[model samples]
Target: MYSRKKGFISRSSRISCTTNEVTGRYSSGHSEDNSNETSNRYLSFRGFFRTAHGSSKLFLGCQNFSSLVGTKSGIEIDSDLDDGFSELEGPTVTGGMLETNVETELVEDDVDGEDVEMPHDKLELSDSESDARKAQVPEELLKAITTAPVQSLDKVMVNWVEKGNDLTRADITIIMFYLRKRHMYWRALQFSEWLELKKQLIFTERDYASHVDLIAKVHSVQKAESYIEKLPKSFRSEAVYRSLLGHCTSKGYTKKAEEIFNKMRDLGFPVTSFACGHLLTLYKQTDKKKIADVLLLMEKENIQQTEFTYRICIDAKGQSNDIAGMEQIFETMKADGMEPKMITKSNMAKHYIFAGLVEKAENVLKQMEGEMHLACRYLLPHYAALKKADDVRRIWQLCEPNARIVECMAAIEAFGNLHKIEEAEAVFDKMSKEGKNITSKHYYPLLRIYASHNMLAKGKDLVKRMSERGCAVGPLACDGLIRLYIKAGEVEKADSILQKAAERRFVKPKVVSYLAMMEEYSKRGDVHNSEKIFYQMRQAGYVRRIRQFRLLIQAYINAKAPCYGIAERMKADDVFPNRTLANMLSKSDPFRKTEASELLLYC
Candidate 1:
């Protein structure tokens, strides 16, 4: 067993810097320490929530990054929420920032010689009657409900249902799906609330799970958990808890994720591979050492590992620079009869290239040559990282014959990384010429290239072109714009972009965008704007990490402003200062000598 005390990161380990020169940002490490004594008992993942013996309700894993959700038009929408939504008011987007609902279907199945209906069967519509009910749906209902104000959603939904239009579960699901696809999470949450209030349908575990997921998206995870408590005990199944766990993992809420995992076991749900896999994913990103604990628990319980489980293990080892350990995991996976997919091979090659094992990476790429058309996107980046411009061109030539939007995107990134700005622009120009169905996704890589090279005029021209083309504006593009203005010393212009984007409720500014502005202000000793953005970030529901506190304190020091309650603020956020931040705090708050002295040991 891993040492329980080792799960918590010491203050000494938190001094690393997160540098992004293109954005003119500096960040202190964001690791969370798990020092609570109560957490030790649950360090092992052996007690996580699992499917009961002979149960039909199996836990569904989170969707893969490349997994596509089918829509009426067959557009492949990304399932990850971090990409943010594009300009919702624009014409129907051919590409960029669309996501789909990947929830498991609520269907009945036979398990252990019994016909078992899944939880949340209330969320499903009868196939035989669905077509008839769908035909009865009012054409105006979706538009009227989704486009209405949050305060008016209830009235609109109620009025539509009372008008005698058949509202089936399928209709409700489609509404939620489209709303989410458009990145109208707030409107979706309102629709869900209206559904819950009507009492027209009895909600099951799946319905509650969907609501909790939406709540976490629109509001905060804390609110989502509170909503869970108010749910009937029967509705709090393994699926519901797993939904909470998945959101927490995505948001990097390590402490809260552990609490939910422990509660799952306390509720008598046995350990399942799905729960363990989530813990592995969480640890892999935040604290790789803790991954061993999860692996141990899986071994002790004899849980059959899935391909995703092996992938996470390989990633954790690769991230830690344990090449031999990573290879061992890959070998073990094959021994267990798990076949690696194309993406898996890409990730392996990526790590190998990062490790400077050029021959090994090339060998892996050779293995992938059979699927070169599909693998070109991955191959281009790997070769680009190796600085092999010829190989990048070679892969492009292969892809050039029938290059899809995704291949073009990879080529842009690869050429940009190689500082082939002209070549990158050439790709963009070709996309425009070939009528490649461009979206904001295609613009971001070139925008990033411009920002990195301080090509302010080019970046501005590109933004104008995007506007002319009606490509959706999203946080990623806005982030690129912010970096461009900051690079040109047009800080106020960058600030204006952030403010205007934030005003659009659907277009939330990225954490990096906020940090870029805050960092610039801090360097100039502009405490007022620094403090303003700091509070804005908090109000935006961003968990304040040590980096924000460090920047805020630096602003106070530069301005020669006396800061009060800095220590209290840090404590409230559970963000303690590292040595560098400790010194900054001492300089900014001279009166708090006692607190400064307490933090100075690291200094």
Candidate 2:
């Protein structure tokens, strides 16, 4: 026997033990020594066994068995054992092995000869119980998990689960759906991984497909393919293949996309027009020839071509400079009872422009006038480039009523480029009356007209209006005003305007404004003020051009200052003076004429 506190028997007590084969109990006879009494009392072997009916039983040894030593009946035990085993043993027994028979009788009495059945516990819950478990997810916890940042999602989920919420499969499915719908694919993938790994939830094929799509979108196509390979063969279906093909086409992995497309065909999957359209668009960039093969494949596979398919084919033809091929595709598209989109018409106009067919381009613009405003914008610049002022006006008049701001602005720029001030002013006034918000853009074009035509009063009024409307006057308008002043020979007025514009910071002075001031100062033979303006322009980060350097060198020579250094400065800036400037410099400084001619060589 072992002491309960010490958990092991002490060595002082030595007792001999005998087993009863009949009763399966061990009987220990203790010594009659008082010094070892405590050890004998605490230490004894108890037989441990289980009944046939599966109930556990322990046969404890009698502490004092020496009282039965002289008796032939049975080993004498304590009063509790005597009462408990009275039915199994008589007042006398034959040998010590009879103790085993007695213990077996005790075990049979405890079991009562009854047969036991194993417990059958179900692993899965019923539908009602599952619903109740799903209801255990708190509304607040659900909201927090869905709305939390991706970085903090793990912490939020762990805290919710720790608070005794049962995150079941239904709850996880709902959360994943919400995340994917919101385009939070990365977060959805993370949540799915946590559910399957941490919670031991098994996901179905649809769930796995969602995971694969999220991986493809947030990570890469290669990672998504690796994930698909790891999945069971039954999970790879037509939907999964189509999704992968779509991603490949979007990323421009042309070779990988073709392989997947061919695999789909070999597997007897339906080739969809949407997938074909993406593949064809990819082919349009690198290999126009391959487009026909894809179209032929679609036809052979009985896959219907969409309007977008025809559009891609036409664009491919246009890219290859095959105008006749493009027109043929356009006719075939119309013959199929499909209307061409705005983008298709734009491509046609571009092809016409490439071929220098201005009339045909104008006709296409007119055809698209009521439906699109961008046509006028595209054709206006073309007309301006050809100096066709009448054609520019015609395109402007043909713009739709709902024309965008950029379209109107483009028309105004074209008019300005063609030197048609009246038309430009008319367009500006029309824009203002049509309730279009007149900003700085509208003022700059008209200001150019004013500068070119010497309309000083109008230019000043425009600048004043810009200030009154809380619109900062831009550099273009400032340049126009200063130029108008200089053209009018009002040198002092131009200098004052430049000075005020620079100091006020409402409008920063550009290089054009500085150059105009420098020219005016040079014209008045005020080389000091001219050089001052030139240095200021340089400090403003304006690159020193040959024309501007010529002006400065002329100013230095006219001022009779040391002029040799000007040529050296020009050479350092890589701006060699031209013939007119070289002759002027040679006459001004005859000693350095050869140096100027040599510097001209570097030009």
Q: Write the per-residue lDDT of candidate 2 for residues 1-603, one digit (tens) a residue.
A: 112222111122111111222122212323122222222221111111112222111112222211000000000010011222222223342233222211111100000011111111111222333353344444676567655654787888789888887777666655654454333455567777777677547766556656666677667678988988887888777667767776565444555677677666667777677667767765554333345345544654577656688777666556555565567667767766888877678778866777677788768767877664446776776677667888787777768366566677677778877988777777766765674445443566677667777887777776655544433333445556667778777767777666655553111355556777887777666778877887776654343355566677677666776566667777776554545777766756646647667999899
Per-model TM-score versus the true fold: 0.69, 0.38
How much is 466 displaced in model 1, in angstroms? 2.4
Model 2 CA deviation exceeding 4 Å by range: 1-150, 154-213, 230-235, 373-603
The ten-residue window of minimal lDDT in model 2 covers 67-76
- Top-TM-score structure, candidate number: 1
